[model samples]
Target: MGETSLRRLPLVIMLLAAGCARQAPSPAPPRVETAAAQLPEQSSAIVVPVTADLRMLERGLDANTPRVLWTVDEHRDTCVRGKRVDLGIGKVKLTPDLGCRIVGQVTRGAIRVAGAGERIDITMPVSAKIAVRDIGGVLGETATARAIVHATGRLGVTGDWQPRATLDIAYDWREPPGIDIAGQRITFTSRADEKLKRVVRRLERDLPKEVAKLDLRRQLGDVWQRAFTVIELSKRNPPAWMRVTPRALGFGGYRIEGRQLRLTLAAEALTQTFVGRRPADPTPTPLPPPSRVAGQPGLRFFIPVLADYAQLEPVVLRTLRKLAAGGITLTGIGPVDVDFGKVTVYATTGNRLAVGVTARVVPRDRDFPATSGEAWLTAQPYNDEGSQLVQARDVKLAADTDSTAVDLIVSLLDATQVQRAVALALRHDFAPDYRKVLGKAQHAIGARQEGDFFLSTDVTRVTTGQLQVTGAGLFLPVRAEGSARIDYRPR
Candidate 1:
């Protein structure tokens, strides 16, 4: 009987060993999974156009005309040819007399601008009056005379002023002459009379010298200099950004609309994001080819933002610590200490964002101890109207732990609540920073003055596109759209 009992004990011992081996827990499932987020190859671009109206040119010309152009001293020399009759004899003689003086004033007429083969053709009508004293030879030295002349003309301005700052300006006259001497009209056939021709020649030579005194080249140079000046776009902490390039400049021709001339100055504004203190003036580059689009001008550009996970990890950890500090109690467990291991952000099947979270949970109660688990959360990102930020919405748990204790803890934790809290915190903390940077950028893209043209930009809308994973961090493509208004009012 003792031998049989020993045999039974061996079998019982074998059964007990088998049961213990079966009951022992398998190695705890991996705490967390690492993931890599993918990004797109190409990003969008920003386009900005600058346009100028010709009517502004007309206004500038009208406003800046000088009232008194030329003045002659009271005692100036006068030369004139006269026919003297002695005993019914007619003879022509040239006489020079003293105490002669003249004064001329500019009476401007309609001004027009035309586009002609890379040059702007400006036509201005000249209506001027000259007061001449001592016009009736030495015998009639006290006789006074007045003459009014009218003609159409153009400014002899030649050079590549649009691309380069070089400008050569002179005066050139055009069309048939209309002259009135003492209210007596003179008609010229085939050729002007000797007196009229002499007066016209004097006008052709003298007017340009007076016009040159205006020094339009220098005025225009100052305008172009301002145009080429660097315009700031964003004002950040250490470095600022700016728009540095003017790609194209040309006339889109002109048209007469009602009482005004509508001229178009087409230009393309190119921008590069620069981050630093404002630098010295850049050398002027050759103007780009003319822009194809006509009429109203606007600008477009693309801004790429790197949302690195490494930088974001601290934010997440801080949020989790705050939640832990507030004391989160699971249904079956007392208050627990929650510590996150590694967090990974990646793109899922549908280009959505998936955040993989690894966590260690230790119950306050001495009986329950500690456990490891993972949570894969799926979320859709969108631009929030309330906060104006790239925010996560529709947060859901994709995968989590299978351990009974951990599973119960996760269930009570409510992935939706956790994800919502994270999304709110991220948006609240990060959105204002993005807005501050963008506001500085918008202010930096200020108004510019070029010649008679005043160009200003208004950023109408700002929006964000999809989020992608990159080696540097999470990449977000932002777009800004705005209109550029160019007014011609010389200052």
Candidate 2:
């Protein structure tokens, strides 16, 4: 071998070494990290349905009916111009005096809600009696009589009643009918003698004072007012956990089908639920404008849940540190350092969530050294019934890594194992404490007592929807549906 050839062999070896070093890609450039977006303050809504049947009102009317409706007492004076009477066997000039009194009562039949133009129609069966006493006149004539009189046999009355009803508003009855006696009949009792009967019929045209005693307005008002009072709903022995405030009441007219009159009642109000304690008395404030009913009649309410990423930082960091302390073994690199850094969360399309994390990977062998990397994970959130919280599920790594260092780390590490570990850690700390917050909210919304009324909420169903990224952490909307009833407990 020549000396020049040996020198050329050394240069060739140097060139080969340079080529080998160039095969590995260059480390990624440092990123100028920006501050993460902050959570916003916002609100969500839920719509509830309300329904009222007119039949329930009828019960109140029946209970409030008075046994005696009316009574009457009347007096009159008469001057006999010329009259001659024979008492026993003597003849005498006589001037007679007269007085009368009558009493009557209204026996009401079934009061029904009439259709469309008519608010309520009722048939009243009336019975009355008459009494007459004639004081002594110039001829010394004194007599007393007791007899039964037939007045209005069956009186049919139709009342046009309008009620005020709206969402989150006050309620009242409008355009109620006045008590009418236009169709009333005036009748006199028949006596055994024709002359005496004729004398009794002379006062038939006079209106019975008992008709004035019937107070239909006051009676009807009591029925409606009692029905529209506060509604109470609760389980036996548990007292009441919730209350509903009915703000307004309105009638949807009525329809007569066969013998039944079906009436519709519209009641608008807000519902509240209590968790730990119950309120002694809670007055109902005017309701806000009600949301339109979508499908059926049922109570509805909205609940907001916030999920903050900051709350999860400590849990995630702890899990990552635990994994790092154990030193994960790689396929070819043996045991390696898996150190995790900061994490940021963001909202994405389709009501989903994304988390970005910074991490470092160091191979056990000093020759490989360590590299910083960034990773992104996408997740879908849902309501976890068992935990009573909204939890992150189906966590997957997003594929848009611009960092070359992160790309190198991906190639050297077991991607599946890392993803699995991260997902498990997220599952542990990715949700808020729903049980605590919701429990407090429920307790705060407890039962209230209005004037002569008790309002309580009866929660039947609770549902949860997907997560929404808003300025206010992770926003989750919850819906609760139930019914509101007003019960009358007189003070």
Best-matching candidate per lDDT = 1
lDDT of 1: 0.48
Locate the minimum summed-lDDT window of 10 residues in model 1: 37-46
Clashes of each: 13, 20
Tens digit of per-residue lDDT, candidate 1, span 1-491: 57855555643454334334433222222222222222222211222322334455545554554433333334444333233445546554543333334444434455554443334445455443444545443322122222334333434333433321122223333433333433433322222234344444544454445434334355444544455555555443324344445545554544444434334455555554443456566577654444454434555554444454556666666776677677667654557777766665545544446565667677676445465555566666555433335566777666544432234224423544467666664442345545765676677665756665566777777776655444444445456667666554546
Model 2 gets an lDDT of 0.42
- Cα lDDT tens digits for candidate 2, 323-434: 7787676654457777777766656655556666677777675434465666566666665542345566776655544432224345332355665665665553223444
lDDT of each: 0.48, 0.42
